[model samples]
Target: MSERKMCKFYNLNVPDRRSGSGDGGALNHTGNEDDDRNEDEGIQPYVPPHEHKLEYSYWMWFSQRPPTRDLSTTTTGYGQALRMVGRMGSVEQWWGLYSHLSRPDELPPLSNLHLFKLGIKPMWEDPANVNGGKWVVRLRKSQTGRAWEELCMAMLGEQFMVGPELCGIVLSVRFQEDHLAVWHRTATDLAAAARVRDAMKRILQLPSTVNLEYKVHKDCLRATNRHEEEMNHRS
Candidate 1:
């Protein structure tokens, strides 16, 4: 099936009416009287049938409504991560979460935010991400707004790093600058990683003056200093 058809297969919106009027003609005197009688009898007006149903397969777009059940929200970071992971599968639901979330540049400095698939944790310890790495794009403080937004859109829209190899993406905002990373499921697959990085560069359309880097999760965790020197030395 075509991409548009695939998207529509998952989207359940009511088809629009072709003709303006129904089978019945304009109201006559007799019909007016019947309508008045119906109103007097407390008969309700007609409501069109809802085309969509609430199911696991469908997700809502950019909704502010929190999960109704208590189980989805817990004290642990892992629990919150789990909640996020569970909601990432359906396109509709992913859109809903996207709508409700704060845009990357709007987050406070020194804040770390992660968006990943339901089963995948943003951290390295998760099975899906254990041997994985991330391509980091460090944006100047001024470019945070546009860069972060484009990166988030590219990640969530599946415009980059196609297939199951993509785990998630993360953004870290700091006083000096902001950092964006696309996390993948395997670090050993250099070809796949290169593809992801190239896709990212194309999407962002960065200038030749700007530089981007990719690092393994293990190396990042072991780094004592958060600087270009440490990163270069590790590479």
Candidate 2:
């Protein structure tokens, strides 16, 4: 399966379609010559599927922990470390960007990939997310790839039924275990949050033993700082 994906999409370094560019042209990773192509050029090696516009535009972001530092230390600095890799306005754009990313298991430890609604930064303290919270579940490395894929699909498909409350989702790659999380606009909205929670459970199909946890953004702010201080003291 992995081998086949390489043949179909661009590699990790490939950039997404530049916003407002003409012809929706993207970088062509495939070696096909121009003569065989139609006037429309949007980085697809094969016969591209019909375009489908998404309800909301999304941004693809990536961050890797440097050897000397840990990201858990501060909310403010965490945003500084993130790099916006792509923007997706349509389903085709999503795949065009996602296909190039390293698989969850293949990612280096301490790396993260984030897909969030456009204009809403992934950080918990962002105005769009400051009052919101996140739903997180740890999974085995083996389960990370598929689960992450399905989660993103559900988000893009609007299956959560939570109506613009969701801010973004993340895949955290670590040494021993991986985690998946989805952030929302308001933790206080119990009915909406509950729907988001139920939708996550159904989509991930997590086993009974697995725990799904929710953390409020404001609460996370103080706790995260305290935890960072403790770790610093220990070091």
Candidate 3:
């Protein structure tokens, strides 16, 4: 779907009503063309069909590197290219948007898709993520589509039992192997990180041959800057 069309389906200014009940109170909702028209006509949002609320709200983002630019998690003005495309508070809402964006493999190389908590920017420096770390797995192009979908479901369902320690998921598209990382809120919480890792393995049904790595966000930021400095010196 076109970016403009997709934005029409999400209410960016949803009311804040998050509740422990995981229902009713939430600052999230998905809209459609009908709802857009209704808003313009001073009518209520188009109520979804059999809408069941999720425990937490989320935002989906899309970003891509310029052909000659190297985009990293630490890159400045990263938000310029990172677009918040959809927000979801219910299962049907997620399915509505997912149906339009079939798979990441279909996206161009250097592109990345992020599904993060409602208020969290999909960036390492975002306060919720600065001290966090991510568990990353590289899979062949053929393996990413299914894995990415399942990972999305698992996170939305809170299957890890890590609580809010689990922040979001990032799917980085590349030419051959694709990298998918699950971000957690605390890097020092080894127990939480371990649970995230174990849960990811079970959810993705990863094979023993698969290598999963963990990198603290701060470490990644430092490494990225160092690498860029080296590249500059070389040139």
Candidate 4:
């Protein structure tokens, strides 16, 4: 089946609602001070501070303005901050950001654009992604635009992998090559990860000669260091 059709099938299988209604409003009973205290002592429910409407505005503002060099002053925080701002946790805002942003080839080498959910850092060290990994597809420098566009469309269109386990996608541009990756929260979830990778391969229509690799975040960190060492040796 086609990638789009497969996604639709999975969506249909997802349960529409919870099976049981146990303690449905237990956390929202304002009068129960003890319950509230207990809940607070435990884990607080996730509430996104930024509004989706504001995120859309920010995305448009950033896209229309030319890229700035002085990130320290121009952007209050690092690259991740921009990603967090754009990831407003709403489908509408996410689509808006993707539609307005430039593709990978339009950006300079070593530049990256991460689209992760709000409150989740793109890095592996983040609590949400500590045990995760990414399925990577490296493209020749000439195919950067093709690979980038295909992966971005698959991700934002929710065609790559569309479950809660789907963390995000990343595009990394290097001097000689570019990479498109789908980040997942669990590296051990082979079935889910395989589905994601298959979706990517199909959408990108990768050449049979190209070999895609799935790397755990821990492994990637090590591989990065090794590559740096090799580059230094060549120099």
For residue 165, model 2's alpha carbon misses the true position, in angstroms, by 0.7
Backbone clash count, each prediction separately: 11, 0, 2, 0
lDDT of 4 at 109: 58
Instruction: Write one digit per residue (lDDT tens) for candidate 4, span 45-142.
Output: 22234523322111110111124433322222332233222222344444544554565566655556565544455666667676888888888878
Error of 2 at 226 (Å): 4.4
lDDT, candidate 3, 77-140, per-residue tens: 4766776666677887677767766477677788888998877888888899999999999998
Off by over 4 Å in 1: 1-86, 222-235
Residue 119 deviation, candidate 1, in Å?
Answer: 0.5
lDDT to native, each model? 0.53, 0.73, 0.75, 0.53
Q: Which one wins by lDDT: 3 or 4?
A: 3
Off by over 4 Å in 3: 1-50, 70-74, 227-235
After TM-score superposition, the amount by which residue 219's alpha carbon in candidate 2 deviates from its true location, in angstroms, is 1.3
Tens digits of per-residue lDDT, candidate 1, 78-169, equal: 33322121133334444544554555555555455566654455656678887889888888778867776687667666687467888777
- The 10-residue segment of model 4 with minimum total lDDT is 56-65
Measured by lDDT, the strongest candidate is 3
Error of 2 at 55 (Å): 0.8
Off by over 4 Å in 2: 1-20, 25-50, 67-72, 226-235
